[model samples]
Every structure is written in C-alpha cells, then in structure tokens.
Target chain A: QQQVKQSPQSLIVQKGGISIINCAYENTAFDYFPWYQQFPGKGPALLIAIRPDVSEKKEGRFTISFNKSAKQFSLHIMDSQPGDSATYFCAGWADSWGKLQFGAGTQVVVTP
Target chain B: DVKVTQSSRYLVKRTGEKVFLECVQDMDHENMFWYRQDPGLGLRLIYFSYDVKMKEKGDIPEGYSVSREKKERFSLILESASTNQTSMYLCASSLWAGGGGYEQYFGPGTRLTVT
Candidate 1:
C-alpha cells in the first residue's frame, strides 16, 4: 500500500503566482516530511522539510504547511518563477537513516 | 559537500542483458539507497544498504539486486534487463543524524534504457 498520496498530478501557474502541492499520509510513525524538486534529466533535490512538531515552516519563497492532526501537508511556493517549473515530490519517513516512502509527484509549470 | 556519483549518465542495453549501475559517495556515510523514478510514478526504492555487506529490500526489489562491498560504494544490478526496467535510477547517501530524522543527498541519476 502507498503510504503517502499527493495531488494534483500536474499544475499550471503564472509567474509571481503561488504554486501549491499537497500530500497526505496514514502512517503516524512518520515524523519527517520533506519536499523534493527535480529538473529535467536530474535527480530530485531537497526543497523544504518540516517536522511534525511545527505546523508550518518557511524557507525563502518555499513554505511547508503541515497539519499533524490532519495527517496532511502542503508545499507552497510564493512568487513562482519559470525556473521553478519542474517535478515536485513529497516523502515521509520515521527514521532518516531508513527508507522513505514517497508520493507520486506533481509536475508544475510556470508560464511567464 | 556530500557528493553521490553514479557511474553513467545514460546507458542503453538489450533485453535479457545484465546491467550494473554503480554509485559512489565521498562523505563516508553509513547509509546508501537506490531508487528508480518514472514519470507519474515518482521515486520507488529498489534496495538499500546501511553498512558494508548489509542490505535490505525496499518496496520494489523483485527484479533488482544490490551489493555494498565497500562503505563508499553501492551497486545496483539488473540480472536480466527488461523493457519495464527502463527508467531513471538514482542513488543517495546520508549520515545518521544522532537518532533524529535527516534528509538524503542524491546523485545526478542514470537514465537506463532497456531495448
């Protein structure tokens, strides 16, 4: 069974708009939720991460709003730019040294 | 910088051929992971090794095997390549975060095409 689910499969936003991607999980053991960004022909890289202790965490233009009670988290990119057009993935893990279950992904497109 | 390097950027092989994808890390981390990424399917774990000669099966380990003979190197082997195995493979490594959760650093990736 898939531990984490994400949506929508694809997104489109204009420059300077907000791009959002949401993910939900059922496993309460997962304590770390991280978002990754991937450019074409490249491996995914860490974008932003949030621990369950905090409801929200923001880094630069990237923000992660997490609702532990809801078992859901969303990534928001403010002032989205064309350079941000890429695939985004959300993952959950209990032990950082162990395996991480990942959501399928969301393809974001930012048009200028 | 924590650097994970994959042996190949792109490779093409025929069905039924044996394929090996090698990954090396420079940070002397204790954890290494292998994952394959497909469009609309995200990253799926193939296998992982926490220490030399110690390995574990991930979600999708049916057709793949892994070896970690040295601390800094991990290898993913496709015993017999199939078209379905054609995907981008990524390798990652991370150190233990004092029992706390930590993120992993990934390699550029190997785009393997099994014809």
Candidate 2:
C-alpha cells in the first residue's frame, strides 16, 4: 500500500504565483517529512524538510506546514519562478536510516 | 556538502545479461540507498546499506541485489536483465542522525534500458 498520498498529479501556475503540494501519510510512526525537487534527466534533490515536533518550518520562499494530528504536510513555494518548474516529491520515513515511503509526485510548471 | 556520483548516465543491456550499477559518495555517510523511479511511482527503494558490507532489502528487492564493500561506494546488481527492469536508478547517501531524522543526498541517476 502507498503509505503516502500526494495531490494533484500536475500543476501549472504563473510566475510570481504560489505553488502548493500536499501530502498525507497513514503511518503515524513517520517523523520526518522531506520534499525533493527533480529536473528532467536529473536526480531528485532535497528542497526542504520538517520534523513532527514543529507545526511549520520556513526557509526563504519554501515553507513546510505539518500537521501531526491530521497526519498531513504541505509544501508551499512562494514567488514561483520558471526555474522552479520541476517534479516535486514528498516522502516520509519511519526512522532516519529506514526505508522511505514516497508520494506519487507532483509536476509543477511555472509559466512566465 | 555531499556529492553522490553514478558511474553511467545511460546504459543499455540485452535480456538475460548481467547488469551492474555503481554509485560513489564523497561524504562518509553511514547510510546508502538504491531506488528505482518510474513514471507514476515516485521512488521505490530496492536496497539500502547502513555500513560497509551490510545490506537490507527495501520495498522492491525481488530482481535486485546490492553490495557495499566500502562506506563510500554502493553497487546494485541485476542477476538477469529484463525489459521490465528498465528504469531510472538513483543512489542516495545520508549521515545517520541518532534517530530517524536525517536528509538524504541523491546522485544524478542512471537510466538503464534492457532489450
């Protein structure tokens, strides 16, 4: 079973707009929520991450809002730019060294 | 900063052929992982190693095996290549936090095609 579910599959937005991706998990044991960004023909890179202790964490224009009670987390990219257009994936892990469960992925396209 | 490098960007192998994918990391991270990425499936872990010569199976490990002779290098071996095994393989490494709260750095990825 897919422990993590993400939506929508794809998203399109204008430059300067906000791009938001949401993820939910069924395993309460998962404590780490990390977002990865990938360009075509490239590997996924870490964008932002949050722990369950914090309800929200923000870094520059990227923010991760986590809800432990609801078992959900979302990534908000503010001031989206053309360079930011890539596939985004949110993953959760039960332990730091354990296997990770990933979402299907969200393809974000930012048009100028 | 940590850097992960894969041996090949793209490769092609014939069916029933033996295939090997190699990954190397600069940092002395204790954890190394191998994952396969497909169109709909985001990333599925095939195997992971916590230390040298130690390996564990991931979500999908049926047709794959892994080796880690050193802390910085991890290898994935396909006993027999099949068309269905064609996919983008990614290697990742992470410094183990005391608990399960560390981030993993990924390699560029290797695209493999089996005919």
iRMSD in angstroms, per model: 1.3, 1.0
Chain A TM-score, prediction 2: 0.97
Cα lDDT of model 1 by residue, A1-112, tens digit: 8899999999999999999999999999898999999998777889988899999999999999999989999999999999999999999988633678999999999999
Clashes of each: 0, 2
Q: What overall lDDT, based on C-alpha atoms, would model 1 receive against the true structure?
A: 0.93
TM-score of 2: 0.97
Model 1 residue B99 distance off true place after TM-score fit, in angstroms: 2.3
Tens digit of per-residue lDDT, candidate 2, span A1-112:
8899999899999999999999999998898889999999888988999989999999998999999999999999999999999999999988643778999999999999
lDDT of residue A7 for candidate 1: 97
Residue-level lDDT tens digits of model 2 in B1-115: 7899999999999999999999999999999999999988899999999999999999999999999999999999999999999999999999977678678899999999999
